[model samples]
Target: MNETHAIAGVPMRWVGPLRMSGNVASTETEVPLATYESPLWPSVRRGAKLSMMVENGISATLVDDRMTRSVLVKADDAHNAYLAALDVAAQLEELRAIVRKCSRFTELVALRHEITANLLFLRFEFTTGDASGHNMATLAADALLTHILQSVPGITYGSISGNYCTDKKATAINGILGRGKNVVTELLLPRDVVHRYLHTSAAAIAELNVNKNLIGTLLAGGIRSANAHYANMLLAFYLATGQDAANIVEGSQGVTVAEDRDGDLYFSCTLPNLIVGSVGNGKGLDFVEENLTRLGCRAEREPGENARRLAVIAAATVLCGELSLLAAQTNPGELMRAHVHLERKSTSTTVGGW
Candidate 1:
């Protein structure tokens, strides 16, 4: 028997010397091509990145700065991409500020505290987090609003509040307060060369939206509402790092976008209900566990728990998917070309099939 000490980089101390039945020890060849099999495959990894976006709402914009710093910047790559120009932390704080300012979400709907705001209706937030940031932001908004209401009596806080969550899908409001009626969503996409696939997919959705009233069916016309394209959510992230594929059910959100002036389209997605905590689940798995550690998201003293960092990661993922669909709809040839390019770049000996 050949002695082994580690599984997927999860090292286990070797207890004994190697023992082989054969007279001569077998020779093993180092396959450099196996590097392609690493969790960070160009395509699969990119998919993993987008899951972050699908899992979280953007600052209405913000990029995965950590990702850009690690993969592209560190490697000295020429170009890079991001959503909102502001740092993700700034965006998070901005949202926090919005909540802080509002003493209440609406009339007779006072918060646990009070605060203020400028944009009467800036964004219809998705509260992208574990369970719509229901408990998380609730605790926060409660404290902030409560403080302001008790202290700043002069502030004009409404009585109604907005936030939502649901153990099951029912009662359309999602159990959230301030569940506004004019909740418009866009399948956000980028106008750059690297992120234009969204046009094709967006077109497909648009066609459905345009004819929905007349034809009463979705894109391919299966069952309009059940048009689930969440396969990418699980496989992509699972193969990349340590995450429970099941959580994706609660964490995957699909939204649509329109209103492009230059004939270039944009798309955005939000999850708003992914309650993923780093320590509890997916702590053990061969390659999965190792992959998380390798990504440096997981580290000693709870380094993996950067909600902001995770949010940024999620935004990047949303951007990718939104762009992919849009591009596919606008020019399918681009996707074909991307596929061809990825295939060519892959190591033939290891990938084995065409």
Candidate 2:
């Protein structure tokens, strides 16, 4: 285990295990949600003060966008691309069945192809249940590739992973096509609540988003993302919940948008690559299991439901932390002061200007 330092005083709050339902690929399971404690809960609490329900929707796609490995096959002739493509299309049912034989929880979602010179890359997307499904997807891909070589005509085997899957890396395709649990969490903060709790107007938060997140990102040449410190929340949540910490690479590639709706603040965080599961290697560990149980995610449910619930809660936690940090940074000295007091070893009240 890497060094685990307790970043104390990061106030945690339980917002929802609220009734959330939608077209999620995984079985629908609602897990009680909690977030890493933060000192900015007062602002977060104000936003949550109003009677509001957080609605979460999940869409399951079978491409282990995090660990998807593609097969690059070179056809003897360039014209064979059409034949190979047609043959692949024809064998869709067989491929699906092949995946079933290989793994119980995985389903073949779609087969995609790309052609370059004489090489053809066959990309498969599958709905891997509960777990992140990285190894499951790769294993299924190998079985299908073996069949393609023996039956398909005029083609030679290529590398197993063609880099098209873009696993564990930041790329444009992950956002455009999507990767893990595509989670969107949204809330509308009442005008009075905004001022009472967040101590800032909706207009101020919206303006900060534009100047800091949107325009500032463009000025700094950031590609395909606009946010201040999503990684901060994601890393903390991942560690607490026993997620693959490395997956944060693509997981952090997301956008936060705030709009002033008349007098209220409409805030949303869209995470295209949130790869979390309730049942996995690290989840069985003592502390991790206890954490999952605390969040109400440890209950036995259908195969994929637990994982889906975990993903939704994770997205919500991220929204809470993101909103708090953004609000704190809006003030001049609050951000540095909070870090110095909550994160620093020395009990110094002042750091540079804190």
Candidate 3:
């Protein structure tokens, strides 16, 4: 047998010197996006331009961050499963100590559980420092699971993953109880600025958001998601930065809020599951390292500060693309015209025209 490796190149661009101020990071930096969709670069740049005009630009606040892994145990009966849950609940300090032995950066922060019949699902949450914490959390969970099986009676190992952790899935549980970095990015654009840059009025954008994003998503049975194209921006940003692109499944489960505050437009994107890290498996590549360094994510700081900075920037980028798409949708034929002009191979189009 032989082994071979190859690289698939995605077109990359630095979209903005977007102004961002929050608990994690405060700076104006251009973000990189790698995607086949050519229009996204210009679209996000427009929103980035809008950010500079505002008072505070994008206020990206990191609400919470934790990585999770759920282990399943099968008890003799439902009664035994309930008892096992109670036993583990009483041993939080012991579990934390066990997690410490697994990795220096892995710290057991929280534990959640679900029981159905004789099966018990224990979801272990951890703060994994600069890494995304997937592997760290899993390693800790493995140790914890071994201890639980030995100490607790009548419970046998079922599986390492119980689907309760809800990794890479669009589940309501992930939204209700977050799995990754929860960031809320907001911008307050003045009425005139909205018209000039976005080519739409404040009131119109707000109304369209309600009627289109909110009501339309509700009618379509979208679960824990309300936005025009979060996946588009997330995919591009994740690909460029060497994140697990599949995590975009839950990452895209966000809400876009547009409010007409008097005449000024108050816009925000709340992304509850932004799973990214500065030092991790995919970060070993040269381009990934370069991208992280450029984004200021590879910095000498506190244990979790680097990952926090990465998450907030990702949230801010989502706000940029989401704002641009919503504004374009406010005008009839504007969306199609841009796509047609930019995407068609026969017609030569410049980025300036967009």
Model 3 local distance difference test score: 0.91
lDDT digits (tens) for residues 1-354 of candidate 1:
999876454222111111111111111111010122232233323322333333232223321111000000011111111111122223454445655444232111221211122111011233322222333333444444444344432333332233122222322322132221112223333344223322233345445434541244244443212212333532344334444444444434333344443443444443343333333345456554554444333544323233333333433343344333333434536555555655566443111011
What's the lDDT of the predicted structure labeled candidate 1?
0.32
The prediction achieving the highest TM-score against the true structure is 3
TM-score of each: 0.39, 0.81, 0.97
Summarize candidate 3's per-residue lDDT along 252-277 as a digit string, tens digits.
99999999998899999999999998
Error of 3 at 152 (Å): 0.7
Overall lDDT per candidate, in order of appearance: 0.32, 0.69, 0.91
Clashes (N, CA, C under 3 Å) per candidate:
60, 12, 1
Q: State the local distance difference test value for candidate 2.
A: 0.69
lDDT of 2 at 165: 77
Pairs that collide, model 3: 16-30
